[model samples]
Target: MVDVTELEQRCADAWPALVDEPLGGWRLRAAGGFTGRANSALTLGDPGLPVPQALDRVKLFAAAHGIAPCAHVVVGAPVEAAVADARWRVDVDHPGGAESLVMTGTLRGFATPKDRAAAVAGTPSPGWWELAAQANPTTAQRRVLGSGSRVGFGEVEREGVVVGAVRGAVVGEVLHVARLAVRPEARRGGVARSLMGALATWGLEHGARVCALQVAEHNSPAVTLYRALGCAEHHRYRYWVPGA
Candidate 1:
């Protein structure tokens, strides 16, 4: 039998590191905010461990704790592989009931300089952010502009009035682009494309070899625009919203 207390401690210590990994998904973020009221489980044993034993341990542990166990699997090495391979799950009793949504992925590298530059120049950026602010002037445009680690370039102007902007910054060799938006009236304009061009130029100058950003999968238009600009899909991430 694995020591439940030790497993929980191990998870707690490793949680932050998981957050830093782009592929760890949003689950790490959820884990950080989770109360002990949330249960977790893991298998710690030699290689070729029995799946039956692992499941039994989780069932027994969850029964005693009055909460479902979050099973963890380690793959490859003995204990490490066991814990890594072990999967965390909840509400196993109800096959169709509410379970956690998994989010995972790696940040994809962008295209080459020549290809990227060409793509950027080929299209125009939208003024979505600019329009949003006008429709709801209470939006926090300036705050998002200033909050990111680095600010790229792009602003939405309506009738010559600048209202929305996109920003980016560089970390190590990675360019993290965030907070992109355009004004309503500026929609369909090449503002975003221009901003992206500026960002690409800035990133290349700063020695950044890749640019990455996160967007909702359902936003087809945005995704299309990005694809046109040489951005490829890296991963599909789902946010397991609280209480859902």
Candidate 2:
């Protein structure tokens, strides 16, 4: 088993490299946080251990940490055995998948202004910024914006007045999809997709070739939409809340 302290340091050190892979962002960062014992005896990235062993290593590490595995993914291995432990929620798909379904797909083009306006008018939910602001009106939104990690690209309107927006980031060769917001009355008219396309286009122009984001696996409708948009699975993760 790895040392808990070392695990913390390793996770931090390894984070920037990991998140650089498109779908990495604030929500993904939050999902990546560590809060237990350390048994990160395995390595990730190039030349890393094979998938089966890696899963075993992660599971062991989770047990050592006293938390169930948060996100467990397996390829080239059986799914049932990997998910046998009670702590994690697991997902399995084809090995080295290309034809497999996407968990977070890359959007490949830019959105037109007309498309952006229409999307803002039709988006269905509040973004992380709005939700954060609602949770604590004074600090979160400002803190995130202040980090210079976020960029806004569209306008949102409510009651015939602009009130919602979309945000994203361009990091190296990948563009991270950050937030999409729309007033409650406007929920299903391709707003989110338009916002995603805008970011993807921005990334390509800025020297990026990939755009990535994540969503709940159970959000079937969203998974369908992303797949239809040409996104393929990059990777997936899960959250292991401490208790009920």
Candidate 3:
């Protein structure tokens, strides 16, 4: 079984925040409000202080950074209870859905798609950025998207045009996958699966054996696709905010 705490830490490392700090074992992250994962406090472990005190620091950190005070907490975990006891309620208005699932699969066992032609590259190509960003990427988005120590970018092209893109980062033996996008015209094809395979191959060479990803619970299509790839939910987490 995957260790939830360790896996969360690796996920954080893979998709790093531009400004991250440690409050004991807890991670306070901020990335200019780029994405929820990069901008929330990861309340997964002990903070070496009273839970209430740690919660206070979380509020101060977010206030100082001009981002909403949010906590990335695992559902049913001890920290979740502690956070709720401290009166931090779930953020119903969270930009990203309030709940998400972290799924894991062994890279070697990932389903093989027929069109495994996503070209893997060490650096993101212009076309890759075009599809992934859908517009000029902000400085914070660019930094976080390209920040991992061992990152691989994958894209599929057709008729000299990019149709799909994905990003993967390797930390320890796990490959953290994110930012998968497929052009509307290319949907229902093997583009997504191909991208996953290509990135998995790249991740293997970079010392990753398992693949992990976070997807919103409400994204049925994504949930179905990942399930088809033999991924199983390792855990679920919710975003919490200061309660009324």
Candidate 4:
């Protein structure tokens, strides 16, 4: 059986926050509010304290980090029930959304023909960073996306302009893919699929077998593409915040 909890932890490490602290088995992460995954508490296994007490710690940690206290709770996981029992409700306005899916699959199928392949590099190109951030990237975005141990940055160019970009971070045997972006004028031309293929190739060279990604439920096009790549939901997580 695929251990969803273990995979979740691996993903967390792959997308590391600039400031990471542990509360027993849980992770309290912050990265200048760059993304919810970085700013929220990862509520998984034993926290080494009562759930309520642990949540108190989460609150304190968030306060110190200058972000709201939010717990990353997997749907149907025991910790989710405990957190809900502790009176924390969903953060309906979470920037990422209320829920997201962690999808996993092998890298073999994402390969594209060489001619249509994206160019993968060990470092992000200036254009890649700009497209991924939609602006000059904040330090947090740059660090969190580019600071991993073994990472690959992929991009597709058209008429001498970079039109697509993606990031892949290999953690052990798994490759975590994120930060995929394509210019509005570049969509519908298989730019994303090409970048994914190149990322998969890079991950394979780095000894990764499975690929994973997180996507919001409402992103139908992305969901469809990933599904076509044979990725399936390993688990789903939601952000919970202080509420009744």
lDDT of 2 at 173: 47
Candidate 4 on 48-101: residue-level lDDT in tens? 999999999999999998888999999999888889889999988887789999
Local lDDT at 170 for model 3: 95
Judged by whole-model lDDT over C-alpha atoms, candidate 4 comes out at 0.89
Clashing pairs in 4: none
By summed lDDT, the worst window of 10 consecutive residues in model 2 runs over: 18-27
Candidate 3 local lDDT, 1-244, one digit each (tens) = 5699999999999988888999999999999999999999998778999988998999999999989888999999988888888988988788679999999999887634435688788898888888987467788888889877799889999999999999999999999999999999999998998999888888888888899999999989988999988899999999999898
Best by TM-score: 4
Error of 3 at 164 (Å): 0.4
- Candidate closer to the true structure by TM-score (higher is better), 2 or 3: 3
Q: How good is model 2 by TM-score? A: 0.50
What C-alpha lDDT values do all the predictions have?
A: 0.41, 0.40, 0.89, 0.89
Off by over 4 Å in 1: 1-145, 156-160, 241-244
Model 1 steric clash total: 32
Worst 10 residues of 4 by lDDT: 108-117
RMSD of each: 11.8, 10.0, 1.6, 1.2
The TM-score obtained by model 1 is 0.44
lDDT assessment of candidate 1: 0.41
TM-score of each: 0.44, 0.50, 0.96, 0.97
Off by over 4 Å in 3: 111-115
